[model samples]
Target: MPEPIKVLVTGAAGQIAYSLLYSVAKGDVFGKDQPIILVLLDITPMMEVLKGVVMELQDCALPLVQEMIPTDKIEEAFKDIDAALLVGAMPRRDGMERKDLLAANVKIFQEQGKALDHYAKKTVKVVVVGNPANTNAFICSKFAPSIPKENFSALTRLDQNRAQAQIAGRLNVPNNAVKNCIIWGNHSSTQFPDVSHATVTKNGVVQPVAEAVKDDHWLNNEFIKTVQNRGAAVIKARKLSSAMSAAKAICDHMRDWWFGTHEGEWVSMAVPSDGSYEIEQDLMYSFPVNIKNGKYTIVQGLKIDDNAREKMNVTMKELKEEREMALAACQE
Candidate 1:
């Protein structure tokens, strides 16, 4: 058997983490044969609730879970972790402005990032799953200067998964038949889900997604809007933010990244910009990425039309404003 890996999860008592921890224990994120030591962390006030979570995990008796550590200490949680799922953050409540939410969450991630830098293994893989994820990831990564920027990513797979499902449903094909769907820019409503290069397989044959849909109007307007506001739509229906789906998307994102994507397939990940597609430096922007040999390379040479460019710019502008707000607050 391979050596057990240590995985750290923040917000361990919260809705998303409640869904996520059980999944990880069941080897949903990692493989079945792999063993894991789960280190769960939350704020001190939540420790009692987190203890109940740990008890339930124990009751499940999952074989892959070798051990469980529940803590309110960030340093203890991050110690020697191989993977860190930074899911804990202040949620945007009713009447809360976006800038206010960003400011609040940035402080949380800033401290956690420093703790990871001080405690986590240098090779640790970090995914920021909290709100304002792109900028939260940016702030976290900035403090972890020792860790390579490429090792950091924000969650955009939820958007990508939403796009794939929408396209597959529209084309009357299985979800697996859709490939190369990309979610670009922020994880917010401004995100652009582009299927320009996507393909749908039918009866042992493949065609471009755009050809299958055959309606630019729907793709540009309704499909885009639906995927962009999916979280809000879920909240409207269920009276809660997306927890189960978001957790599942987090699993998919980490699994694809850890195992590698199949050739000719790409997924969206929010990584620091290296000036790809003329995006400014130091921003965490989502882009089409291919993973192989446990490394992600941004897919190159995709054509962006004027409309797509305009939408991408809108999201990018939001990220910039968020970054500015966060940086100013951090300086205060």
Candidate 2:
């Protein structure tokens, strides 16, 4: 067997990590033939809960997990890690403003970024899954200058998955039938879920998703809002933020990054922008990206109609403002 790749999960005791770790240990994200070491990190107060999770993982007796280390030490968690799923961040509290939440998380990610720069492998692949993930990822990349910008991404895959499921449900087809569901801009409600470039395959005949749904009003308004607000809807129905689905999306995001997307297929990832679609450079913005050999290149030359352009600008503005706030917080 080859040497195991080290994967780290922060907030290892959290519900999403609870759902994710089992799948990862079973080779759901990385390939089944590959061996891996799991580094589980959380706050000191959560160490006991994290230990229970480690015990549960051991009970499963997963063969691929060569070693498991549960710790409250950031440096230990990040050291030599090949991949990081940054799931831990301050949750928004009742009556807390958005800026306040950003201020809290900026400090957390900034410190983690320094750890990654100082200890993690230069090739470490990072995906920020916490709330305000796009800005958080940008902050992390800012601090970890040695790690290539392309190596860092945020979890827009969940938003993409939600868009696909909504389309599939509307068309009464399998979720796999939807292709190229693009999530543009931030992960928040301002995101533009563009079916303008998406397609639905039914009976092996591929048709544009808009044509299949055949409801422009619904597509332009209801579908967009539904995809953008799906998280809130899940929270309303379950009285908790999504866990199982969020875990699945995290796995999918990492899997695609480790392997590669299929031919002519693209997925949403919030990667640092280099002025794609007029989005500000250095902002972590979601774009349809195609991956190959563990590297991602944003899909280019997609036609953005006037409507799509307008919506994209709104989300872009939000991210710009978020970056400004996060940077200002760092100064305080």
Local distance difference test, each candidate: 0.91, 0.93
Which pairs of residues collide in model 2?
none
Q: In candidate 1, which residue pairs get closer than 3 Å at backbone N, Cα or C atoms, i.e. clash?
A: none
lDDT by residue (146-230, candidate 2, tens digit) is: 9999999999999999999999999999999999999999988899999899999998899999899999999999999999988
What TM-score does structure 2 among the candidates reach?
Answer: 0.98
lDDT per residue as tens, model 1, 85-104: 98999876544567777978
For model 2, how many clashes? 0
TM-scores of all models? 0.97, 0.98
State candidate 1's TM-score.
0.97
Q: Give me the displacement of residue 7 in model 2, in angstroms.
A: 0.3
- Give the CA lDDT, 0 to 100, for residue 98 in model 1: 72
